[model samples]
Target: MKRALLGADDLFPTGGEAPPWPGRLVELDGSRLLVRDTPATAPGAEPALYVHGLGGSSTNWTDLAGLLAGRLEGQAIDLPGFGRSEPARRYTIAAFADRVIRWIEHSGRGPVHLFGNSLGGAISVRVAGLRPDLVRTLTLVSPALPFLDPRRSSQSRALPLLAIPRGDRLATRLLTRVTPEQMADQIIDSCFADPRRVSEMRRLEAVEEIRIRYELAHYIPAYLSSLRGLVSCFLRAYLPGAGSLWRIASRITAPTLVIGGRQDQLVDIRVAPQAARVIPDSRLLILDGVGHVAQMEVPRVVARAAVAMLDEVSRPDAERPPRPSRAVRVGVAAAKPGSAQVAPA
Candidate 1:
């Protein structure tokens, strides 16, 4: 049965109190994925897909998806072993990318406006590079691209732990000591520039989500294996070969918008410039006082920038603005209203 689209009154619940969008299990290539649909508010809205970062679920895109409902009918997927999805056979980036490809193919939603964060950004890069025909435009939020000398973030420190033997056990033991509420606080501290920006309701919601995920048997293995897989990809990303993400970025034909936070602890903001430089047709936006999750930190600003990109792309070849010859840096001040400043790189 087809579900009714959310009306304007239902779109943005008071105090962001709306629960997650409705989701259904989808069978694709012998795997089941949980997908949450945020129906478009307009009749001719374009199809879009949202891929969350590692350790995140489809709910990560809730705010951003709701904000973009006027322009995009979005589907956010739970990669196997995360959210309500079943466990996967493997947790490698390629495998995850393949699953995303399968879903797009299965749904016949090719050439979609693709949005990804952190690990999902890495996966989306692979998808866009490998199958350009399936993507219309790309937006990455602090994508976990290869970083040779990764910044000394908490996440970087955890990488070594994942490399150790029986790391999953060690991780399990460590996680056992931390309550879901504490875990949520740690995540907020690490992912946001200022922890105070997170509402108490959101914090409670995060704790509840973490508590539920803790009960799942596959959660630990999935997280540890995925981290290890990402580390492996990092090591392999710099080797002399056509497989490097840098090389892949050069091959992307889609007009891309790369957003990063100046205060990002996990993925160094320095890499954002390099990412924009490598992607043939891409622009960069660096938000001051924002952290790893720009989409979540400033959905309205992200939405404005995203809508701008969509508008530019939808214009005819003659009407479209000329592509900037060099990288353009846009700085949005603490997501304040009308505080975005654009300057030539």
Candidate 2:
């Protein structure tokens, strides 16, 4: 396989606080969001919107967004309660999806390529199902969908705490006692396949980021609410017919790409193919050594796959080849959204 070609911009930031990358705040009718916009180097490139995972900000997409800048005009959003965005008055998966849809609709950038990771991935799926006309294609990386073993996930472990009376406050107080650097280290251990791979500079940056977020009075509430929303979504996804994510995935008309990390401790990698099976026009990619945040860990590879998927879907039906069945497509390595090859476990 050919290595993915990448520029310096496709790399993670090394310096602290603000990096050299360009970003701005986008204000909608009811809310404001921080967006990292990367304009295409050439004219008339397709527009793409990226969503981050639970507890993550738009910064999660910084590397991947930059990598895809040449092929797509991309915007990485910090969902409400994460990053710089304020907490939503009512936090729910539907509410979050609605806000994203509103932003795209107001910006008149409908039918854009939609990419999401973790919670954002689930939100992107919701958007694709609700407003197919607004989504050109869908790409999900470690989407926070329901998994068989909830105990394997950190989010699941925290669910019990939320059930307690005044739980959110108690959790906040406990979190405050922990320093940002310690929290950053814990995150690295949980999210990465190899924690030592993170550089000292990057660690410092993460520490600073956590420090700022920890200082915010709304931070804990936002995190707690988002957690509840995701848990609620997972419960809803298990319902029979119509209401399930399976139903939503089947309804998506846009071509789709699903990415998973083999060593993902949060969302099980085994579920990747199951996710791809529901999307009529979709393929799955599982990275051997990677964990939860594939786009962050392997930005160039994910970007290359994304570009290829987009190109394949862009072709007219008469010109395009017959798509492979979901089972076959799930089996193939680096499978095209429409190809049929058995994926290796």
Candidate 3:
């Protein structure tokens, strides 16, 4: 596959020229979801759906979606209880996937280029697996899948603990003690390899977002519930044949891109290669010095890679012949080096 190169300016666009993120509340399954529809610069581009990570809103895709505007008509959704959306009736991954499926079916916009991060990744996996007709392609960034690695940070360790009776209350109290700016700082520290690299404008935006999220009456409850749901997903020891994420991945025929950040503190980097291996028509891209949120932290890098994948698959099947049943590794990092191979257990 050909590698796409993006200019430095593409990564850091000037103010005002940044792509527009127009917000709309779309109802799916009787629940309102805040979505950002970014029109493509080119006419009649295919539709793409972006799902943000846990606690992330549609705004998280602002930069990355803009960069892909030339090739895709992008829409980023605020999952139930996040951003401007209301709390969901249920908080399971299946529940979240069902809402997305309903929206796509109702809108007659099936088989879109689907992109997801963290918790959204797991949700997208279920969608692509169960409703393969709804996903044209799949892109996952630092997906929070189950793994047996013991080298986890406190943030991850705290997730399963939220299931305890008083866990949510204790966590809420600790979070409430911090100012919004401090909360933003904490998030940046955990999600970015270099928090200082975040532009001043972006920093201000994040601080304001933190403030708004903190003010939401249902925010903490929703966050805790989602975290608990994710923990349950991780704990399920499904057999290899059925009801497993790897099994779900194998059923997906869509061309897939599994992206991982070398410095990601949440999801283990090794999961990327494993996902690529399981998904038949998949490729892996590991970005150096990036963290959990590659779309937000390194939009240009991710945009180029995504566009490259689209370009490869867009060609005639005759010209772009399918390879053997093995997954491909499509990218390498310059800032830091790590094994891109799927390591054995």
* Best candidate (score: TM-score): 1
> Which candidate order results from sorting by lDDT in descending order?
1, 3, 2
lDDT of 2: 0.73
RMSD of 1: 6.8
List candidate 1 stretches off by more than 4 Å.
1-17, 323-345
Best by lDDT: 1
Quantify all predictions' global Cα lDDT against the true fold. Answer: 0.80, 0.73, 0.74
Better of 2 and 3 by TM-score: 3
Residue 332: error of model 3 in Å?
9.2
* Steric clash pairs (candidate 1): 111-134
lDDT of 2 by residue, 178-227 (tens): 88877887887778666655556566767787888877888778777878
Look at candidate 1 and tell me the lDDT of residue 172. 84
Lowest-sum lDDT 10-residue window in model 3:
336-345
Report the Cα lDDT for residue 240, model 3.
43
Among all windows of 10 consecutive residues in model 2, the one with the lowest summed lDDT is 336-345
Clash total of candidate 2: 7
